[model samples]
Target chain A: MEEKLVSLPEAIRAHVSDGDCVVLGACLEAAIPFAATYEIIRQGKRGLDVAAPISDTSSDLLIGAGCVGQVTGAWVGNVSSGLGHNYRRAVEHGEPHALKIRDHSNLSFGMALLAAAYGMPYAPVRTLLGSDILTSNPEFRLAENPFSNGGEKTVLVPPLAPDVTILCVQRADVFGNCHFWGSSGVAAEAALAATSVVLLADEVVPPEVIASDPSRVLVPGYRVSAVCHVPAACHPAPMTGRWQRDSAFFDDYHKRTRERGGFLAWLDEWVLGLEDHDAYRTKLGASLEDLRIKGEALSAPANYAAH
Target chain B: MADYSTQELMIVAAAREIRDGEVIFVGMRLPIAAFGVARLTHAPNAVGLFECGIARYEPSAETLYTMADPANQLGAAWATGLLPMMTQLPAGRVDAGFIGGAEIDRFGNINTSYIGDFKAPKVKLPGSGGAADIAASAKRLLAIMNHEKRRLVERVGYITSPGFLDGGDGREKAGLVRGGPAAVITDRAILRPLGDSRELHLTSVHPGHSVEEIREHTGWALKTAPRVDETPPPSPAELDALHRVDHEGHWR
Candidate 1:
């Protein structure tokens, strides 16, 4: 097997191209690929299209950094703080330059990714009938159900295959078999739909460890282009069984990034100024220890004894 | 009856709409809080289906700031990708769903997309996450929002979720197979669509609120039910349940 392990910077540099449509794994607060997102911002990649089905904050940060020009998603905002300041500014005032938005509900967008993974042209859904989302986005169309009566209508969403997908998982092998628990979100479909996969793992386990429980592997090695072992990759965001969400950081981020100046200062302090994720980790320091998962609810071990 | 805050009243009212053993498609913020109350009190067997593809039998082990919070996944009954969980909505498996919007019309048509126009907006609110799907397909939909003239509008700027599109048989004509908005639970009062008109009318008022007060806050000339009962104040047990669910008071 080809050696897929690489440094975070090299993996990002080689796999991610300028203006590539990128999809980040996980929905809202679980296993967000923030390490890779910060790197992309530091690299100053522009005109990129970000797929944010239910953006937690990375999309907002990327937009704040002027890296993203287009966004396709249902929502982008801070869960606790309400609006995404940068995202709101970009759309309402064009502060970070105008952003093109193609709105979709969570199901429609996820189904689009699923369709792409299946190599289908479009996915038919039952939502978005009377909503303005159908009329506004040209990509979503209404059609009569072929097998049903002419009156039966459904919405057809075209496939959306991202150029690259970035995921942060609990563990993976050097050959890139990712194992993660908690809400999967649309990670599997997004990974399968993307042309290239950049996998970020908290631990790079041996191939034997991955083979121990085959069912836990959400994404196979054949689909992954690069595997970078980046501990604490999803800082601020929670990685189930690993750490808890740093609510203070998110609250502080919301407070600090409410305006253009605050956002820029925040971008400089957090992303551009830092050398790498290592420096970022160092800055995090004891807070990492504080946020570490304390309680345990271990799943019963499954038997895999072969005759 | 014990004194209760409007937030507490809203949570209990929303929870009351959910029957025992119902499968609820839970949304973010207040809906999650209400679901927790329902699970702990009236609806013990109620299963919450999150948009992140989690079927939770119990409330989060910890406080949840978001729908996809890691705590929500701790004791999930089933966990999978978003597609499967969301597919259950259109597949007619969901009994009821919860949604909140920036603006909602008398018909319960919600707008969470933009405040002004489709092409341009005065303010860009968070777009429909899974609300459109839930509103369109859930057996019955429950809407929760703050009671204000600006929020309870005559017509929304954009239809992010379908309710009774233009009232009478509107949802059916729109090709929606499931029941539309059954009730709108707010901090002040409960509103439900009435008669063949399907226009939302004041069904009940919370403890100190009156019909005139609700009308003053509503953008449209809201109709009143034949006998508008005062919404019961939250019981001690309900308040306790809510506090336990929202330990941090994030939603409260």
Candidate 2:
């Protein structure tokens, strides 16, 4: 097998390209791969079509930085502070450029991604029926359910196969066997559906450890194109067992990105000026240490006694 | 009875909607806090199904910032991704769903997409997050929002979630299989779809608030229940449970 391990910059440089349909594998939840996202912005990737089933500051930052040409998602916002200021500006005002949006419900979009993962043409769903979501996106088709007797119908959601998916997980091996534990949100499906995957690990462990608990592997090593060892990869967003959601930082982000000038300054100070996650951590100082997981509520070990 | 804000009363009212042993697809904001209150108080056996695919049999140790918050996964019955729980909606596994919106019409059609034109929006609200899916298929839908003219409008600019749609079997005609807009729980009153027209009517008003005030705030010609019932104030026990659920007073 080929060595998949690479630095964060190398991973973004090699796998992610300009005009690529990128899936930021976080669904308004923990383990948002912001380190990789910052690198994508720093590298000046352009015309990128970003897909986040349920987004947050990650998508907004990309849009604000002028990297994103379009966004396909259910929701995009700061979650805590308020709406994504950059997103609102981009869509309503079109300050940077006109952003093409393909709105989808979390379930509908997830089903589309699931269909892609399963190598299916499309997934049929019963939802999105009397809503304008059907009218907004021409790709979604309402088809008669041939299986049902009472003239029932199903909405066929097109498969979403992105060029590359960036997944930030709790741990991964050099071989890119990713292990994640938390409230999950289509990370596994996104990885499988993408043509290639870039795995970002906060703590890169030995292959032996991943093999010991194979059930924990969300995405297998073979599907991964590159693995980047970047601790605090999901900073500001909790990485489950490692850290907590930095709501104060998010609040600052929300405030700073209210205007274009403040937003660019935020990008410069946070992404451009900072060399890497380490420098960003240094700038954050001791406060980052305080956000570490305080108490233990460990899951019971699953016994696998096979000789 | 303890002195509680209308927000607290609303939360309690929303909590009371949850049956003791039903699967609910809980949306963000007030619904999350309401579920917490429900689990901690009356509906201990209720199961909360988040859009992110978390089946929470018990309330989180702390209040949730988002439905997909890590706190939600703690002690969860099951933690999968969107597909599993979302699949439950069509399979008839969900009993009721809680949805919120920026604008909602008398027919209960919700708009969270945009405020103005579809192509060029004056304000582009956060697009439908699982509200549409839940609204379409959940056996019963409960809409929780503030009682304001802009919110309770004559017609929403966009239908992000299907309610009665145009009313009078419109949802069924559009291929929606399940129930639509069971009730609308606002800060001032509880509205339910009445008659075959399915237009929302004022069923019960919270104490200290009159039918006139509710009608004044409503964007449409609000119909009143012949005998309007005053919503019961939050019990001391309910308030205590709510405080513990939202210790930080984030939602309150």
Candidate 3:
């Protein structure tokens, strides 16, 4: 089989299909490989299901951009700050379906995916047993009331095997063996549970180097269908890379998003106007320089000492 | 005691209880504000830890940036970087924790996950981030939230943190309490655990809030302190400090 290396969008387009369930692993703003998500959005495929441990800017952006048809996760805060108007409109107006899992239940989503990856019928979860979550959601039910006279009070969550898992990491090899120094377990589990995996990395290093660090290797190349080398891909946001967050852009976006009209206008200027992350950075122009200074100031020693 | 505005009051009251130089884990949103206020004012040496791994962060006087911000690493007097800080939190090194909730039962069980249903929820919220570990491991737990019937329920829809477990010697049975939720601060009043029942009782009501106001919102029985004292209002200086830390006024 010929191995493929391409940009994030190409890698995603090569694998993603309509009605495919997807899992993503990223922090609030740093996780989702925007390049891939943008491709998914541009494709405008429906019947897509997404499961993330936590939803951040990328997840919200995808939903807002009309890419995700169904979402299951813990919370949607910090994704464009408290569920963007698009997500709210979709869920409230019944345009798209959304299933909001409770915190306890949210943990189970990850556990269940882990179980599925391991080929289990269902994962035994301790979350949301006594609460109304069990009684309310038919998807979750009491396997046996462990509280009952020596019985097991196991809450059974069905397996969640996504069709594709998309993750962005700090570094990877040409063969797709990846390494993330920070929290990689969440994304790793999502990748294992999914049918296929696509990795977008900040840099493409030699496979031998990744192999040498047995402990740091998060995802093996065998599981990955494709690898895309995209530096500073998580733009207008922070990523674990050489580049820092474009704070000025974020502040502007934050301010504009609070106002409904201004948000739509800002989205147009940023999301619609930009062809890619590079374009977005270009449009900001002087503001990006200002942000660099602010970023440095915010990260400076004097500031730390003052606090 | 400082004269605190609503925002400053929340921070000061919460901060006063936190000792200096303690490792306090903080959840996102309001708790972040309270932690910032506490760090900038009372507990200067106290470390502010986020679930995402920022530790002992010295945030700018203005703006509590995202927990993941690299700026979170700027103020660390020590060499512990973001990755190390993230590791320590789950390993249970944090001393105190500040959390907010959508609902809190008598047992101190908190729910910030969902409202309405689970499989299909009316509203989805940010799930617990290191809440379970913080609740389980922290020597002290302090909760700050607005008192409302919907929030101060008899039973939470979900138990994100094990609050007094099954009650009585139950926490001991479940092995959940090294130290657990010591106090709960709300807009209306403050509450503490009563006896071994794990139930919370009112210790004091803020000025202008009556006992009935507290009781009306409480799903469980509301107990009164031996001598209830009004919480001091935030002074202008404290308010300015708080606003300076959180310029967006989202903390308010």
lDDT of 1 at A80: 65
Q: Which digits, one per residue and each the tens of the lDDT, describe model 1 over residues A1-307?
A: 8889999999989988888999874555688889999999988889999996875788899988898988888888876677899989988999888899998998899988989999998999898888889877888989889989666989999998999989999899999987988888889999889999889999999898888888888899999999999998988888888878887888999999988999899988989999999999999899988988878899998899987
Quantify all predictions' global Cα lDDT against the true fold: 0.87, 0.87, 0.63
- Interface RMSD of each candidate, angstroms, one decimal: 1.1, 1.3, 5.7
lDDT of 3 by residue, A1-307 (tens): 2455776657767789887887764353454566666567666666677666554555655666556766665445453345344444445444334523223333456566767778998876544443434443468756665555756456677888889988877788888888775333356667778889988787898877676665566678888888888765556555543445665555555556554466557656766666765675577577555444233222222222334
User: DockQ of each model against the real complex?
Assistant: 0.79, 0.76, 0.22
Report iRMS (Å) of candidate 1: 1.1
Give per-candidate clash totals.
Answer: 0, 0, 12
Candidate 1's error at B2, in angstroms? 5.0
Q: Candidate 3 overall Cα lDDT vs. reference?
A: 0.63
User: How well is each residue in B10-114 modelled by candidate 1, as lDDT tens digits?
Assistant: 888999899999999987777788889998898899999988878988878676767666777788998788888999999999999999989999999999989
* Candidate 2 local lDDT, B1-252, one digit each (tens): 437888888888999999899899887777877888898888989998887778987778775666666677778899877788788998899999998889999999999888898789998887887888889889999998889998999999899999999999999899987789998999899999999999999999999899999999999999987778999998888898889988887745
TM-score for each model: 0.97, 0.97, 0.73
Interface RMSD of 3: 5.7
